[model samples]
Target: MVFWITLDPLSDLSRPPGDLSSGDLLNQVLYVALYCLTMAKLIDLGWRGARPLLHPAYLLLLAWFAVSAVLGVNPGTSVRRLVLCAMVMSIVGVLPILPRTQRDLELWLGTAAMIVVVLCYLAVLLVPALSVHQADAPREAGLAGDWRGIYDHKSTAGPMMIVFLFIGAFLAGQGRHLFGGVLFVLSLVFLLFTGTKQPTALMPVILLVSRLALRTRSRLLFLALCLGALALYNLMTVGSAVIPSVSDIVAKLISDPTFTNRTGIWNFAIDRFLERPLTGYGFMGFWSTDAVLQSDPLGQLAWTAEATDSHNSYLDLALTTGFPGLCLALWVVVLMPLLDFMRARLDPTKRGLALLFFRIWLFCIFVAALETVFFLRDSAVWVSFLIAIFGLRYLACYPVRP
Candidate 1:
């Protein structure tokens, strides 16, 4: 599921790293079809005794969608977002009432983590390898020398793996240390090999925040040691004159104003949003119509670059649905952590789930500041479902003592 969701965005499908087989496209469509069918089946079965779409979160999400439908610049895009939201909500709706004990909670989370691992592994197998030119740039090989595997962008892979890594790390803390440690290590290695700088920068910030939020006994000490070790690791890998020094690499990263010209796109989006402060461009409105995109700052900076959505999600939302839309979405995101903290007191088992979701959500938002996040499916969607599930599930599991 993650593979299909990510492949389009990450692959260099422009030139395509490998052969362009019709079979490949067929397989991709089939994948989506199967996933949708499975979700539908699950919802169908659950409907016999499942909760209705009357939940508050469902209402809020639906209201937001209706607004987008009426006001959205691109009804098609707005509709797509709405459908995705509905699918996710359905998943949340079917979750069995909250687990009665800490052990039950662990089982649920463990199942999810295992599924993530399996999906990522399958992605590694399904996508074909493609060789990219390295004449002026780094001649890096993708999943396989030429295979990008499931994802198109090298950057997305890192964050995707980071989420898994945190999940694995939490599992390790729960006493499945050996298995968890291995999973964590694999995820970390995958992130490093991707060579994407954002995840490299974002992961530590999340890790630090998670430790503090979890209020672990040795959090401060752990953070200091980890930071020191990370510095040393960078010194070894990127700093050696024999190799690329961290300083040299970081300087190069900073010098690239575009970060692929995302910054310019963000600025353009902001300006566009300012034009429609109350209900900006209708959903998916900004990119479609010729009037939608007034200028291409990205095109001016680079020889040939595709400027799709604004690089930033916040800007994208404002551009699509206006300030109200953006604010509502942001509210959904901001409330996750506080909700997690509250749930943690009721169910200690939920602590791990909360920590994992919190970390992923935090990084998603951090990445969103620089990158438009919704074009591809991501952790944000999954975390949102988890938030709704546990929020309702916990309430059902443990009624108020009073």
Candidate 2:
């Protein structure tokens, strides 16, 4: 778990360029070291409580990484990501082992909630305060809007918090008594302040779905009314002269067109794929030297300077690691959660929690359609979520409450 917490330093690019003459190699070494340490600790622990690590998803992820390494254009880069994945897999592996009781679950959740509180504050208030730019198209996004965050980008952090929001909302719903309400409220506020589109859209949808899922008779009707009211609010605000900011943002959304030109990038990447159609330009290698090989006919794209990721995880996987890596990555994400769905339903009480977590995870996947390539990055947080689902699955199989 400690490895999981700090494994990110391996991927951290914020280190001063002069401090580390060579950035990439240092990051690679750090990742490898972290992986070794975590594996050694897990082995020393006798694998007594290490169940999740042995799961199908964990094994598949490792295998995918191995394949990626063998096929990777930059074996070193692939290796670093592989090592980071191993650390995260270890954390998930340890989840079922460490917190075996409700008290433990509550304690862990409380600690996580506290961390979110601090992180959210940093993200919202402190980061915004540190902002130096104000223009819509400034030289840099500034602290106020890094687009990416302390980790990778808002794309990652935003979806990550949505997962936490689901967890908090679930616990709060499960009768956490007094503290639950506070957690739920904080989760909502944090979700809003994050300002990512998916959370903004899905939060209300989750609340509505949760109310229905809980079987609160008539509550569904109330939700419908509330939704109507929300529609009315949007309708009234859409053109009202009183709210210029809202109008400006809406106009921007409308005018920007086709999701900020994601279609163009997708088309360009696909055409490049058609060129090689088989191996492509070696994993993560194209964007560096051979990006021109990509098909960006529109010339309205950024294939060089700001073209680090493809936004779509599947597309990025295909482009970087080819079809084989793409298949494995998708399988690990989709199959694991779907498998847990049954275990979740086995116990009606925990079904909602299971569903909420699943929804949040899927929401990330959905948002990935237009944002970051999460699997390529240090996905410790998402991996934690997968571990949590595994834990709940075990709880379903071996009942404790009854």
The numbered model that scores best in lDDT is 1
Q: Which residue pairs does candidate 2 place in steric collision? A: 148-153, 148-154
**For residues 105-212, could you state the per-residue lDDT of candidate 2 as single tens digits?**
765765676565555555445554322122333333443444333333444455655665666666666676556666666655655555567556755665665445
lDDT of 2 at 111: 63
Total backbone clashes of model 2? 2
TM-score for all predictions?
0.67, 0.70
lDDT, residue 101, candidate 1 = 55
lDDT of predicted model 1: 0.54
Local distance difference test, each candidate:
0.54, 0.53
